[model samples]
Target: MTGRHILVVDDEPDIRSLVQEILQDEGYSVATAEGGEAARKARRVRRPDLILLDIWMEDVDGITLLREWSENGGLPCPVVMISGHGTVETAVEATRLGAYDFIEKPISLAKLLLTVERAFESERLQRENVDLREHAQPIIEPQGKSPVMAQLREQAQKLAQHNSWVLISGEAGAGKGTFSRYIHDQSTRREGPFVEIAVGSMSAENSAAELFGAEDGETVNYGRLEQANGGTLCIGDIADMDLQTQARLLSVFQTHSFTRLGGSEDVEVDLRVIATTQRNLEDEVAAGRFRDDLFYHLNVVPLHIPPLRDHADDVHELLDYYIDNMVTHERLSYRHFTVAAQNRLRNYGWPGNIRELKNLVQRLLILGSGEEIEVAEVEQAISTQSVSGEPTAQIVPYDLPLREAREKFEHDYLLHQLMEVGGSVGKLAKRVGMERTHLYRKLRALGIDHKKGIE
Candidate 1:
C-alpha cells in the first residue's frame, strides 16, 4: 500500500507549511496551496485523496471555494475545513457543502490525524458500496471445486504476493476479468481502486485520451492510469491495443510515470498492471502488431486459464452456483438439474466456458417450467442452440495465421449455410450474397461438394 495524496489550502504560510510537514511525517504525499486560486491549480495538476481547506482566505473565502468545487466537479476528494473563529453555524454550513469534518484552528495534532484517517476510511467504504450497487454480480474469485480451478486459484494467490505485472491468457468467457479482480482483492493494494480498461472496445481516436488522460485549460480528465494510482490496472484484450498507445504504455511501465495529453509535467504513478488477452500475444509480437518489449514486461507472470472443456467435471458445480445466483438475484423460480442432465452437460463441450454455463442455467430457469431439468431438455437446448448458429462449440485457433483462420471460418460458415438452405446452390448463393457460379467455384476450392448443393 502507498501513502494517500492530500492537499492543504490555507492563507497562512506558517500553518500550511506546518501541516504539510506533519502530514509528510505521517506518510502522506502532501501538496500545499496558499489560497483558493492556487488550490484550483494544484487540483488541476493532480487529484488529491483528501483536502484540508481553511475558512478564511485573502482572495476567495474557503466556504465560497468549497461551494464552487461542490457545484462544478462535486468535490473530487474529501475536504476537512479549518477555521480560526469557528461557530456552530459555520460548521453546519461547511458540512452541508460536503466537507468531511470541521476542525477549529490551533488544530490539535491528535484530532487532525484521527479525522483524516476517518475521512479516508469513509471514502473507501462509500466507493465500495457504489461499486457493489453498479455491478449485478460483484466480482469474486472464480468459483469451482474442480482440481484445475483449485490449482488456478492457488497460483493466483501466490502471484498476488508479488508486485510483478501479470499476463492472463484465456478463451473468451473463461473469467479472465474475474481472475484479475480476484488477484487485486488478494494483493497488498486491496483497499485501492481496481481500474479495468477494455482496450479492444476503445476507438483509435479516443484511445490516447482515455488511457493517458487529457488536459484542456481548466478541465482535467484523469485517465485509467491516473485513476488506478496505487492499485492494479487490468487491461483487457491488450493484443488489440493500438501500436501508438502500446508505445506510450511501454514508456509508463519503464518510467513509472506519464504525461497527460497536452500536459508537460510528468505525473508519477505507483501501480501494478495485469493484462488479459484471448489472442496469442507471442504471435501478435511476431506479426509486428504488439511491442516485444511491452509483451516481455507484461508476461513476467503468465497464467493460462483452461477452457471449460478441460475441466468438464466442474460443470456440475458451476451449474449449481449460477442456478442459485439467478434464483436469489433474478428472483427466478428454482429448478434442479437431474443426474442425467448434469452428466450430459459434463460430456458436452462449453466453447464459451463459465459464461456460457451461467447463460445456460438462466435460460433453463426462464424457459423450463419443470421442477427438475431432465436430459431430454438439456439435449434439446444444446442442439437447438448449435443449430441456431449460436457460434460453434469449437474455440477458434486465435494463434493461427490470419489467412488460415479466415479460410477456416469461411469453410465452416458456407457448409452450415449450405446445409441450412437444403442443398440448393441458388438459395445458398442468394442468401450469402454471391453469384451461383462463383459460390460453386469457391466451394470447390474449399473442397466442399458443390454438386450436392446445386439447384
Candidate 2:
C-alpha cells in the first residue's frame, strides 16, 4: 500500500477502471491495461509489484500472456488471475504458471484486497530468504559489544526515528550499506521501498536519466527517486554524483520535486534521503567539487560509522558470526577457531575492516582443513594478505590520468615527509627543499591537514 504499483489487465474498460480505482483508493499507484498487448507494454514501461490479469481477455488469453512472460524472462512480478468462468483445471494451470492466487470476475472486494496484501507479504519474505541464501547479512544489525559500537547502534536507531535527511560517512566496506538499511528498517518508512543508487558506479552521461527517469511522447520511465516515493532513497557515494546531476538533486531537495528528462511536469517527491560517502565531503565542498547547499541539507543528521580497527574487541564475535552464517546459509563445513587463532586475529590490523574480516573467514572455511583452525593457518593468511597488500600499496596507479597520478604521488610524498618531520612545517620545508610559503600552499591544495597525523 505504500507506493506499490499494481497493474490491472482486463478487456472490459469498466473492469479495468473499476479495479484501478479500488487499488488507488487503497493507497496503491495503479495502472490499467485493456488487453494482453497493453499489459505487456505497461510491464515493459515499469515493473508492477502485483499484476491483476483477467484470464478471459479478447486478444490473447491471460494464460497465454502469462506463459509468454514466464518463458520470455519470467513472470515479472506476483500475478493474480481473474476470471468469471474459471474451471478447476484452469486454476491449476494458472497456479502452475506462477499465479499467486485466482479471483472470480464478480470479485469480492474484501477477498481481492486480502489476496493482494498476502501476495505482497509473501513476495517480501521470498526476497528476504533469497538474500539470506545469497550469504548476505540476513537482517542482523551491527554485531559488536564494544562501547563505541554499542553507542553507535543506539545513536543510529534514535536518529532513524526522525524525519530528517541523513548523511552517513565511513571508510569503504565499513558497512555503510548495512547502516543505511538499518536506518530505513528503524524508520516509519520501513514499509516503503528502499531503493539504493550507487552514484560512484554510475557514469556521467546516464546519471540524470537513471536517477530522475525519462519521458518521451506517450512513454514514461520511473526513476529511482519516483520508485522510492513514500519511502527512503539511499544514495551511496553521493560525493561522486555528476555535477549536473548534483544541481538537479539540489533543486529537488529545495523544491521537493523534479522534472524527468524531456518532461515539463514536475514530479512531487515525498521521501527521506539517506546519503553515504567515504570521502571528506567538507573537503569536496571546499574544493568546489560538491555543492555546499546539498552538503548542508544532507548533513542535517550526520552519522560516522567507526572503522573496525577501533573496535577490535568485536573481531572474535564477528569471526564466529560469519562462520555460523557461512555454515547455515552456504552449507560450508564449519571450523572452530582455536583460542590462539582468535587472539592473533584480534591483534591483527584489519586494513579493510569488516569486509576484510568476512572474506578471511570465508577463505578459511573453504580452504582450510580440520575441525579447528590453528594459528598457523591464520598467520599464513595474514602474511599472504600483507605481502599482496604491500606491493599493491606501493604501485603507482597507472590507470589515473598523468596529472592525477602525479598529484597523488606528490600528496603522499609530502604527507610522509611532513609526518617524518614531526608535523613541523619548518622542518618539512627544509627536508622537501621548498620555500615555507609554497609548501604551505601545496599542503592546502592537496587537502592535507598540516597540523594532524603526528604524536
Off by over 4 Å in 2: 1-48, 51-81, 85-102, 133-139, 215-221, 262-264, 386-455
Candidate 1, residues 201-271: lDDT per residue as tens digits? 89998999998988777566778888888889999999999999999999988898888998888888889
lDDT for model 2, please: 0.82
Model 2 agreement with the true structure over 1-455: per-residue lDDT tens digits: 35788999999888888888888898899989999888866755555778999999889899998787776546657999999999999999888889999889788889999999999999878866664433344545888899988898998899889978999999876778888888888989888777888997789998998899877654556688877877889999999987789999988888888888987777777888999999999999999999998999988889999888888999999999989987876567889999999999999878778877776777677667899999999987676453212212245798999999988888877865664443568778877889999998889998888876222
Give TM per candidate.
0.79, 0.72
lDDT of each: 0.84, 0.82
Error of 2 at 6 (Å): 4.3
Q: What is the Å distance of residue 304 in model 2 from its true position?
A: 0.3
Per-prediction tally of clashes = 0, 0
Q: Using TM-score as the measure, which candidate wins? A: 1
